[model samples]
Target: MKKQSIKKTPAKTPVHGSKPALARQVRIIGGEWKRTPLAVLDSEGLRPTPDRVRETVFNWLGHLLDGNWHGVHCLDLFAGTGALGFEAASRGAAQVTMIEHNTPAVRQLEATKTKLNADQVQIQRSDASTWLAKTGAGTARFNLIFLDPPYHQNWLGKVVPLCQGLLADGGLLYVESEFALTDSADSVLPEWMTGWQVLRADKAGMVFYHLLKRQ
Candidate 1:
């Protein structure tokens, strides 16, 4: 089968629908779902992880992360519209727990969860920080965890450690940041990266992608 490309459209972008005035497609980025479209959220500026970024993140993850979809349990922090989690589900992940706080985004996520007919996904409408801390203890217990917060919040530092307890040994963590790597350890390293490989740091324009392995 031919592989489909990931496409990005602004949130609340209008499209046509038979049921009413118009509808939008959330659009899946990988697996049999590549190029698949769902509805758009009426939320403000919900960017849905750009296709290039998503593709690159997953590309590196395939090499660095241990699990290839199946048997893997994922945690998607800031899971806007359920993109990363749903993509993982489509790629064969056994389970995905998604956390998002925005009501419109959450509503869209819930809608997507139902529309995809996805059974492997668990959706939660909760604050990213609270959920990560509440979910796990300090053992590094997840196969994958995604962290992509709103750029203005400068939240990466505080939230990363909260997620550490949930990451399993040899687990992989992918962080999408709007800022470049700062000089201080306090600025970037997730408390969970205490013994993990720094792996790689790739930056493009305003976006920074860090790949870390939980040792």
Candidate 2:
């Protein structure tokens, strides 16, 4: 489906050190926390996946999830709003770890966790690339991973291979980028993706979402 744009009045700029206006909320579409609202902080480059895009991604994952999503472990590497991680936890993922370097984002994640009493989710304030490099698959492999880093930073180039290493056998990785993967000059795939294969790909407005699996 072609994504539609929602028109809204421009937000007023906040003064330095002043409290920023409340950003819009992102709602979980399924599982225990279905319809629950998560605050999206007004951080620079903060873009939560669009509702239609997330709905499509989860639909692609539905069959694999089974009934309770038992024994599933997930990682949200960029974790701007903890949306993916929290949604996985709500669906009964054994554990969901969210990693974000932004302090306010981390605080909001903690607040959401506390609000939902989500014991199965862990929030870490750290650079996603550094953390992925430091952590080994043997000690911390995840069955599902979400990668939605700031666009145009070459972050995907650095993190995709690390996520591939961190994924267990048959694991899945979901990525969101500003350009479609088919456009090579615009979106470059890493050379180390020998074990990686695209499972699904779709475009939502200007954003491209992909689901991959490690073979």
Task: Assess each prediction's global lDDT (C-alpha) against the native.
Answer: 0.74, 0.85
Q: Candidate 2: how many backbone clashes?
A: 0
lDDT by residue (92-171, candidate 2, tens digit) is 88999999999998999999999999999989999986787678646688899999999999898888877877888888
* Tens-digit lDDT string for candidate 1 (45-114): 4656766767777777766645467878888888886778888888888889888898888777777778
Count of clashes, each model: 9, 0
- Where model 2 places Cα greater than 4 Å from the true spot, the runs are 1-22, 183-192
Could you tell me the lDDT of residue 181 within candidate 1? Answer: 45
Task: Name the lDDT value of residue 52 in candidate 1.
Answer: 71
